[model samples]
Target: DPKVDVLGLPDWVKFIFLDIGLASIVFTCILGQLTTQVNASHMMIDFINNYFAVFTLYTAMTIEFIGIMHCAYLIKNILSAVSGKPILSNEPPKTGFTFAFYWVRVLMSCAILSFCVAVVFTALLAGDTAVSVKYPSISPPLAVVLLLFFMGVVGTLEAMQIAFFSVAKLPPSQRGTNWFGSKTCSLLFDGNGKNLPTFMIGRQLTVVCSFFLVGSFTSLTIVPGTGNNIFGVSDTSQAFLNYGFQGAVMTTILASIMWQYAASAFPVTFLNSLISFILLIVALCLEGTGICGACWV
Candidate 1:
């Protein structure tokens, strides 16, 4: 009765996720209002700049954590349901962990490792210290760890996709009368698909980031003596700065649209990456031409 089928999550679980997402929206609204107030008051540029970036990063990470938790639940239920494994129905709590719990733990561990790597890179690359300062001790290990963690996550997703597709491919002869229930396949493959719980959260994260970007520009415009201080955009040259702003806006629009509709995660990820690559190139060109120093930050 508890089999997962195409709906990888229970109704109650879905409701919980909805609540988390709603809560994040509320948080964003509060922060956005605060940002507006700060700008109106003409707060110190240094403080506003730092606060905005840190707040955006924190919100993104917070929503990402929520998404990862949702993903863990969906993955556990789907794997258990499809594999005909015993659900976590029990009379009392046990000291021993179940198979589903182990898998969830593994996924969480990988996520944590990746998070650490991200933190190291962010600190080293974007900290107040000059870029010349080398983090030689941490950089290499961080790269290696991230590479391994990424491989694990990708491999697991690939395995799950393969399993679901194989089940989908089962013929009527293989199954009793009908092919493996079409509903399950549709649930996993159609619309948003079970493979992209994170993308759902990402949609909101993008909106929050976009709002912050807009707020940053607004703060710079309204506050005296803040031009180019926040984003390091050139006061003299507007070409690269304009391109970066446009790119951010377009990225946010794309993300918002995906939030409304059910787009497959794979393509969304690809598009985001492509957009980011182009932005990075623009940033590099700007820096190379001495127009600005990391205006895209």
Candidate 2:
């Protein structure tokens, strides 16, 4: 999105996905080495299962961070719009500006962030606290539940707040093209009669489902991992293999994200970040399942 072309971003930030990919490479190697050193003759199976497990579990965080950055593109556009401004050339906003002028914008952004964190944390703590009584360990299932709770509560609110506020503040002329677009924004911000809760529930369900699908795929790999397999790849190899897939996913996902950013900038950018993100999701699922099947059956 034209919004994504912020000029001031360090080259490193722009290429973070590759960096993440490289880190996964290093992580895989280290994990494999550690497994070999520890398990000696019997390490292969353990390594395979563990390798996949690490990447699968870590995927949650990885996807989430990328998604959040993905959100930044929309945010920048909506934000610059709010300021009655348009980015001249994807240049990064000047730094060292007197906070006195931009504090409201800065504060608004920070408050939204704080609320997102607080709500997610509270929901997680609540779920963990609640689940502990029945399920002792922090199992994968419980983790998913916690994540669902986070998204269901915090994710919707975060999206709503940004979407509405941005949509609301803009002139009717620019507030999305739809006749109802501005109306919807006003409704969202006004906390319309029970509409907010209903919309929130829908959004919550959607996000929770997204997590569940990903979690289900990840669980297939990890849950079986605790079991024994004679010829299963060691956890280390599994992690590296999984890491390789994740690295690939991140690379594609990153490209998609950057494309999405560029697309947001002017009008037409022949790219979509979501395409690769979706592909990455599928690749991880296939690779994760492959490892599981290889070892389990």
Candidate 3:
């Protein structure tokens, strides 16, 4: 029983607090949301129907990324144990690539925040007539504004916490006795303090690329009866046989290949990039020419 206390907390304490209590609370909240119909309409149901496939695809990709990272972590630990080398390292990255990626990530985050703000303003100004009709008592603009405000507040707080605690490099004196700063920094960087932001950026890129690729493909195929073939194709089977889907698939594949390089802390050399691009083009040509269906979108 003493040996089983991994975090210096009893097993029963963990089970009670985490497994039962926290899980029950989460379940209750979800149940409440389902019962109440948060949007007071079939909007939630519609959203699920329309976007659930893409969500599942993104979730699956993210899980795979996590699993890969976990495996790498396990292998590193195993090698460290065998060789008697410490897992932790105090060395900084030799290249400026990590800092460059970090700045790019910051810019991307700012762009996304700006886009969200624009969407909020557009929603406030455009005022959905259906939403207005659903809730006759409440002003549509007011409701939209209030919803956006609440979301903005929560997002801002979360972003601030991530920026300050996870990304920011605090001095040793400011890190405190508990070493929370070090733990946070470790989450963003590896043991050798390399790729400070690529891991996070790679994750985001994976999810976004997966979403666009899978979402576009599914949207074309997963429709009532026949399918939504905007390409004026005669056959529904070839509904996704279009430039858009090809582009999405290619983009996803390129991102995935680049992510591999980023994860390995290798700079994206022009020679390698050219080779990758040529190989992808050949693969796409083969798929397009009906020679192989391996890269089917």
lDDT, candidate 3, 172-250, per-residue tens: 3343233343443343344664333232222222233233323222222223235433333355434333223433332
Candidate 1: list runs displaced more than 4 Å.
1-124, 128-233, 236-297
Predicted candidate 2 versus true structure: per-residue lDDT over 186-222, tens digit per residue:
4443444344433433333333334333332222122
Q: List the residue pairs that clash in candidate 3.
A: none
In Å, residue 179's CA in model 3 sits off its true spot by 30
* Model 3 CA lDDT for position 43: 60
**Worst ten in a row by lDDT for model 2:** 267-276
* Residue 106 lDDT (model 2): 48
**How many clashes (backbone N, Cα, C below 3 Å) per candidate?**
0, 24, 0
In order, candidate lDDTs are: 0.37, 0.39, 0.37
lDDT of 1: 0.37
Provide the global lDDT of candidate 3 against the true structure.
0.37
